[model samples]
Target: MRSWKRRGPTYCKDTWGCPRSQRKRVVFNKFGQPIGKIGKKFTNFLGTVARLGAELPIDQFDWRQVPNEKKEDAWEVVQDYYDVDEMHKSWTLSNIGTKWKDWKCYLRKTYFDPGFPCTDDRVIGDQWTGLYAHWQSSLAQKHSITNKANRSKQVMMHTNGTQSFACKRYDLEKGSGKVLSRPELFKLTHTKKNGKIVDKA
Candidate 1:
């Protein structure tokens, strides 16, 4: 819920020849990391491509033949050539909900915390154990409390919708008593681990 005031007229001075004044920009923040700005014109162009049901025309780009300096210019020309008004007509931004916040917070905590097990090994222990341990360690460090019951309660809430046997241990420890889908658990763990790798790599 932040707003940005335009500092000056937007203009494209680069080789693409897009009118700079017509550009619109949106900025996004995921957790604390800034995703940066995306121009309305670029988004519109992508929408146009989608509406036209056309694959972006990159067939002419032969990587081996194109010189480094000229390759950028070639891409711009290709992008501009495919830009059409029809794509702009279908473009709209919609809210996708905030279900990702807990996961994002967990990842940020895991990445920044020194106690996280994966700091030494790229392959963390079994996904559930690693994530739960990270969460438990983070809470313990942050709150300075050693009560196992309190830690288990936090883990249950944090690991909701996760179905690993480790998650069951967490649930039983917390005394909430519920089960979740194994496939869903696997998907969540894999996706988060992959994201961590991508971020570090």
Candidate 2:
């Protein structure tokens, strides 16, 4: 049998008992929910699909590995994260308030949400080193860029009881070449301006 699921945009709270994530979604990594591509058939004559018995938890993803050649071509966006001190705290499930968990969830939104790959480059330094450590460092870098830009912006409320947040981007004609330097980055959000469009570049 097919498991129950919400098909539409998840942030909806309709009167028909649909669930909503309120402001948005908070990623869950504590548990794994088994999911399968196929369900049952109309009759035993057609053979029924079996339910998947296992699933890897959200945190099982390996960060140090990525498709080498493919990573350069898929080039997308510079995933961003928030650098808060709490992210360094203990993330064991026993800690009802886990900073590490919070940080991981937020970072994931930037990666997969922006169509970026899940793999990350391993950091080489005296700080911390390991699967989790690499992510912590990279996410910190992303967080700084986004946080700085956010702090520099101003939001205004309109007199008509409306509010909007818009920032102008200059240098729409700037051009830059591509390199595969590990630190430089292959994926980054598009900054195209002046109504220009790029089909494939």
Clash totals for all candidate models: 5, 6
**Candidate 2 per-residue lDDT over residues 145-185, each given as its tens digit:** 79669867744312211110110001111134332332222
Taking all chains together, the TM-score of candidate 2 against the true structure is 0.16
Best by TM-score: 1
Candidate 2: global Cα-lDDT? Answer: 0.25
Using Cα atoms with residue i matched to residue i, what is each candidate's TM-score against the true structure? 0.18, 0.16
Sliding window of 10 residues with minimal summed lDDT for model 2: 44-53
